[model samples]
Target chain A: MNAALSWLESLLVLAGLLSPLMLPMLYFLLYRPKRRDGLASPIDSLDARAARPSFFQRWHCGLKVACLLATCFLFISPRGLAVCLADVAIALLATALSRPSWRRVLARLAAMSGFLTMLLLMLPFSGAVQAGEPTYSLAFLPDSLPLRLSGLGAATLIILKATAVALLMEPMLSTATLADTLHGFRQLGVPASLTQMLLLCHRYIFVFQHEAARMWRGMRLRGFVAGANAASLFAIGNFLGMLFVRSFERTQRVYEAMLCRGFTGEMPRAAAPPMTARDALKALFWLALAVSPLVTEMYFADFMRFLGE
Target chain B: MHISDGVLPISVSVAAYVAAGAGVAVSLRFLRPEDLPKIAVVTSAFFVASLISVPMGPTSVHLLLPGIVGILLGPAAFLSIAVGLILQCFLFQFGGITALGVNALMMGVPALVCAGLFRWLQNGDRRRAMCSGALVGGLGTALAACFLALFLATAGENFFAAAKLALVAHAPVVILEAVVTAAMTGFLFRVKPELLCLPPRSKWRGKGDCSL
Candidate 1:
């Protein structure tokens, strides 16, 4: 009964610390600005969303930043694997609830699985060989298991932590549009110029993607197929070089256009309203909640020790 | 080539950010105000470049093009790479938010190195420039693999095998990158040789024009 009570208490402490990190994400999901259809450009739609902000949308950026900060802190703390795993499970549940086009996450995971598999396979055999340590061998031959079971445990720990963070990123980022996130960064004092540069880069990526696709189709028309040979490589080289040349020319034209339009160095953004008292109070509450994990880790451990004594 | 988040300890992550920050600072110092748009455009190209894959067999592999960025952008390659990586993180979730600095370093440092090497060796010699391009591409991938291994090894003894595996898996990629970079360099040599030259740092501040 006592053990169950202690476990329940510890779980509660974790929940208290974790709730602040999670509530904002939930709030953003619930109160995210409704998208207005019939917008010609996605950028225009993003602007429309900003024009009619919800209560939670106003502070979503700060909330995400706070949650991520807390998550990072938790990751860094000397918590046990079980606790960390539990936190990761919570994050995974949140991500699933957010309902992103999850194929992206799956694809990324597919890419990462190779590395993770390598860790899983090799870590077991790489551990230091010690006398009287638990060892297993492949086949009947006496092959030394230099990999201690403890090493495998550590590898699992790192993998779980990494996977958890990666899974959590989708929901954390997906709920807010990229523009809003950048704006939030600006609110957090990231330079306006940098955000502007990022926005420009983001916009042009689609432009170049289309250009490259068109060029690729042109190549297909010319009967070019990728092959493992010098000639194919040369063809690819020409294609890339041509792409760069076109992109360079476009840059010059873009520069000229910007200058013609009175391209001052400043990036134009809609002014955000100043933070209110309620915003501060809510932020403080979340901030306190975020810190609770560290506090609990420090004090709860001692409390358990005291009880034992 | 992107290091996922939570793989790095906070201290290592912080250190990488510091190092990458220093690189960005140097890049910004050399960047011209007028060239900001060019940088943005090239940043987009770098981001999009990853999507263009070449079929090798049943599967396809994309170009990293750190060498190409280096050959083209010179000192500013780091900033371009940083922008590309940030976009990839936000849009594609290619790398994690916290690992941004480390991932940038893994790609950007190699780009800067290749840029310097290509400049030192190209010297208006077409044959030599192509060779240098191949060297830069191959060596850049190799070095990135090394960095990845070193970072993984920091986790402890258990990761040693994993590190080795990472490097080994990249061997074919290194050769393929060398071939592609060489091909691109050769094409540039015949077409637009001037693109091989680094842009003037800042028109008002730098000594010469952006030409070979």
Candidate 2:
């Protein structure tokens, strides 16, 4: 009976270690089936959602970007687990209040699973082993594979902080159109050339994505399969070459058209509306909320000490 | 392979942001106003190309294309990469908002280095240029992996293992990028040789191909 229990524990630990490697397979098997109908444009759906007015939508784009990004930085600050949890709770509340599509938020989190899983698998064993630092060893496993508790705690903190910032992204970006958000960056002193490039690049990504899908389908019809081989890589290379050729030709025509429509060296910028007192108040509220977790972690040592222990 | 938020210490993240900003400023110093739209359009194509996933055993890896972008765009590759990364962050959340600086530096620095290497080595004929492209493509991925490992190591002693793992994972990708970039270069040489000759920004008249 004792041996059986030890074997079970070893299997559990092994499973925990290997699960992350299985995630990509599972993700493809479950989620990829729904995406067969060509590439769906995320921008159209996001723009439609942004058309709806909400509390976050009312804030000036420049101020909104600054405040939310500040919150994200604060979320990642070193703190106890309780403070991390509070940061996550605040992020979730902000996300909910902003009224974004639940599906998109979940998708954002899913995109992060790969990197986080890597950290989860490697950090525990890789941490510097110190004297008296707690470690977990399993029966039927190599003695060298000691999972450090301190490393586990560090990983957990990273995971929580990463999740919080990722959740906050939907509320920060989806509340405004891409162009408007970029315009906000311009107002915040980002170079105009860079902002223009972002806007123009974004506008054309959908077009090129469609072009690429069509080319891919055509390649498939010609018996070109994408596999782990030189032949597949060669075919993909040809496909990309053709894509670049076509895009370069199209750019000349596009530029000519723009010139015909009175294109100057610079794109015209729309003047931003004056900020109001309510916008300031909302910004202050969010800023304070962002700061609360750090304050609690730093000042209320007695309250946070128990959670740390 | 992009770094996510909260993975790096705040100080490292801030320092990366500053370094990446300086890189962009240097790239932008040679910018031509009239070429803005062209660069933007090319950037879209680069973005789309990166979305393509090539199958590996059991799993797959997406193309980084830093070498190709560098070879094609020359001095503008850094700026183009920075823009592409920002779009990836907002649209797909591939890299975190705060970690954007780190991601850009990881990819963009290699692109610049590969571009310079290709320009120096490419000579003689189409076959030689293709060989140079293959060399630079593999080198670009290798360099990016090194940067990633170096950045992760900055977090603490605990992350040293993760850093090593990240480097090893890119080994296969380096080979894959090499083959694809070579094939693409060969195709371009056959189809439109003019694209291979990216003229210096000051000398480009923006109307016709440079002397080939």
Best by lDDT: 2
Candidate that would win on TM-score:
2
True contacts kept of each: 0.56, 0.79
* Candidate 1 local lDDT, residue A164: 68
Off by over 4 Å in 1: A1-63, A93-99, A103-111, A130-133, A138-142, A145-147, A288-298, A301-309, B198-212
Q: Which stretches of candidate 2 lie over 4 Å from their true place?
A: A1-5, A10-33, A36-46, A303-309, B198-212
For A70-175, candidate 2 gives per-residue lDDT tens digits of: 8888888777898899988999998898898876676677778789888987888786689777677767756677777788788888888988998888778888
DockQ of each: 0.46, 0.69
Q: For candidate 1, lDDT tens digit of each residue in A136-217? A: 4433223544335665566566666666666766655555666666777666665566677888887897788778777877
The estimated TM-scores of all candidates read 0.81, 0.92
- DockQ of candidate 1 is 0.46
True contacts kept of 1: 0.56
